[model samples]
Target: MNKNNQKSKDGNWQISFSPIFRYVAVFCLLIFATIMLGGAVLSFSQMKSNAQVLLSNVHAQTSQRIDESITLLESLASLPEFYDPNVPPIEKVKKLDQMSPYFDYLMICYVDSNITVYSDGSEPASLASRDYMQRLFSTGQRQVTDSFAAGADGVTLNYTVAVPLLDAQNNITGCLFCAIYFDEVVDILKQSAATSGYEATLIGSQGQIMSSTAGLPYGEPLMKELQNARVIGTTPDKLQEQLLAAEPGDYWSLQNGSLVYTAYQRVEDTGWDLLCSVDFRTAFLGILPSLLLVAALAALLCLGLSFLLRRYIAGQMHSVDLLVESVEKLEKKLYQDERPENVDFNEIIRLTSDGLSDALTGLVTRSVFLNQAETQLQKINPEYTSALCFVDMDNLKSINDTYGHYGGDVALKNVGYIFREYEKKYDGLVSRYGGDEFVMLLINLDDEAELRSVLEELVLRLHSEIGSAGQQINVQCSVGVSLCQPGMKLEKMIADADEALYFVKQNGKGYYKIHQN
Candidate 1:
């Protein structure tokens, strides 16, 4: 054919395919949009449900801790030594001090009607000015105080769990109180926040923030902080009223240009409220990969239809060059097209695959652990020493062999629990590296002596026997420790710790070793 004739024929084919391509593209786009919208809504609903469950779990745990304090104090109050007039305060304090070892409180003390606080190794101090003490004395009822400075230096924050002591005639004589360090509650909040990617705060009955994982100041009015954030669905005043009325509800707010969802629940038997908040964007992040995959598939379907149309049109024409040119143009367009802007595929990947947590251990996954460790190492203080640890479960295979995989799982769960306890206690990072292996990064240690003491306690705690199917299986672990040095990378520290762990396994299992050189 002549050049003009060929151009006319190619133009005709293009005109014929234009309408079909447009229709297919538009239909695919509509399908993609519908799928994305539905996916987003369902993702948000699932996120809300997850948030509610997390809040409920944290609330129950906080309530249980508070109730435990009250129950312990009440049990102690029933002791005759506390209410007996003949028993001297000094003797009572000695007896209380002996019992203190069994309880988790900082100290157990006896408070007289005059609000005189007496405990072992401390002079009697008058607590007359304390509001909770005054209320307890007046009402002859148990009282739980909010976080307050209680020590001689007036810098230590503590919660007072006090139960009124009654005499034989039912007259109030004195009170039995246990002073709990506020950091204990803070650890609970921190752990829940860390595992769930949320912030947790404990609010006093008077609307004061007793403890917050978000670093909200102690004794700050919860309403004041809410006022600073742009609350949605309700005014801050109404929210404060709901909190004061001990109502459980959820609220959304805009803080620092990010939307946050917060759920509040009242801790039973205490004038306290627990709030759990998370960034709203995270809810969508979990489902983004699926949405992206659906969109990609839709695009491919459209592309495939276009290819079929091109084939049919090419079949009608006798020229092979037109088909080659069309495909070349299509390939160029595919590569030259701009990618979607501002989409963080790395974050999307991280959010998926169990959402940055190990399903079995409830600890951060390896990627998260490495990121956190590197950040902390960069900011490490010279005055404090930090240590990295490699832990290997020694009896996992044996447990699985004898009692089945269920027993092995139980043993690993116990290890997770033990590691988490230490993580909270030491403010460390813990992660499950892979099968039967875990890593821990403990920062801000006072000295090697303190690290040694911690390792000793950890080893002792890990050497317990767990029961499986009416049979006792001994569960143990070997730990390898490496003290972090200046300018050391995470990989090197992990290698050192692994070497130490190898030494322990070679020498004797169920022990710990510090890396040498």
Candidate 2:
């Protein structure tokens, strides 16, 4: 019922909960995202390393096989029967039969002659037409060649290792040749890739596909396929450029919405590239289940944390909620002598007392100013001169039209800011009444000259500083001042100021006027 009792009741309500919890949650989410990104990076690196090691092993195994085949051909050349010109033709042919079980096929061709010998006991084919045999005869040297051979059955693709035979006088005698089926070598490349789920290819020196477990047609120019394919994360043109410069290493690209990790090794002995690749989704099959489990656990943790945080926040504000309910009961009784029971909070009442301050300008709201101003005025001496001023911004609408409503808000805030300065200097109350409007009450003006001086200083300071709020509009205001009288209700006093403000609007704006009545 009394002012002091009302103040005591207000003090019982305590406010809690800092506003920074939202920012804390956002920061935690950022940390989680960073961790997931790092995990993904490490996963890809490990998979790529596995691919590189597998490809290198395939290169080593293939190279070793080639060396063994060359050694076999050189040992076969040591036998004397084929090189000795004194031996009978039937016996030398029998020596060729002795070479059986060593090579898949064997041939002996005399130097500067088309006569040929075979260990298979099949009909002899002329070796003069074969490019590889011609080279052996003319150069009298050892050679390896990959080409189609004309056999009695038909032309067959073959890989051959050949050696020259020399007479005792160091003159050319004949040549020794051993052959392996091309399909047999293809089986070797396929065996290396069998269990790994990787597709393998043998790329020729001419950029063609000699053999492939990928089902590409043999002898097709592989560069045409690389150039025409659409590779993800890059245009087709750029992908072709990269493929041309691709070397013996590992690389990544996307195919069919899945990442592919490819590894290649150059077979220096054969002038070829051995390509092997595995898909990322298939390679990481064991890891995805684990990653999903981790992601699910993280989601549960976040949800549990959110639930506990909300309960904690509610518990902190329990006293404030009760105080609000008590205020509602007090309002219904029409200022009764009975007071509500007080809660036991100390500093929270002070924290909430000024919560109604304007967010933009730090001035109090109209209701807060009116409630506190009456009490402030009660202590003022009637003999001392005082004034209440109402202020309305002049260029707000134009500012909004020119630079949008944000600029209009900046203009109103500029005017409120000036009122705040006057409030601090002259020890009065300033409140943002509504949009583009503010009210000021100076308790002890001393004289009209002091009021006039303060108003002039506010106008000059506002004009100089308002445009710096970063909007491209000039700021100005119109004001009306009403002198307070003894026993004047605040409502009547404010109305008097409003009437003066209306008169300023009627005439030229951008200036202040006093109440005539």
TM-score of each: 0.55, 0.50
CA error at residue 248 for candidate 2, angstroms: 5.2
The worst-scoring run of ten residues by lDDT in candidate 1 lies at: 1-10
Every candidate's CA RMSD: 40.8, 16.9
Instruction: For residues 1-517, write the lDDT of model 1, one tens digit per residue.
Output: 0011224544533336777788888988898889888887776677667778778878877788878888888888888778777888989888888777687778888888778988777789898988888898899888887788877788998888889998888888889888887888888888877776678889988899888888898888988998899999999999988988988999889998878888888888778888888775776676779888988988898889789978887676646566646755753553365422222333422434666887766678899899999997886775787899999999898889988997787777777767866875677899989999999998888888888999999999889887656778798899999999888899999999999999999998999999988
Query: What TM value does model 1 have?
Result: 0.55
Candidate with maximal TM-score: 1
Clashing pairs in 1: none
Residues 1-517, candidate 2, lDDT per residue (tens digit)? Answer: 0111222355444433344456546655765676566556756775676667667767777666566666765665667766665775566556655654555553432332343644345555566767667777788767666435445566677766677776677665666666666777787778777756567787765667878887888888876666544454555455334445555655566666777777777764455677787776666663556666666676667667766886876676676667666755643442243321221122222444556876655578888989987887776667677788888887778778987876666666556655755775577888988877889988766777877887777666555434434545687778888888888778877899999889888898777887866
Show where candidate 1 strays beyond 4 Å.
Answer: 1-3, 6-35, 297-517
- Note the residue pairs that clash in candidate 2: none
Local distance difference test, candidate 2: 0.66
How does candidate 1 score on lDDT?
A: 0.81
lDDT of each: 0.81, 0.66
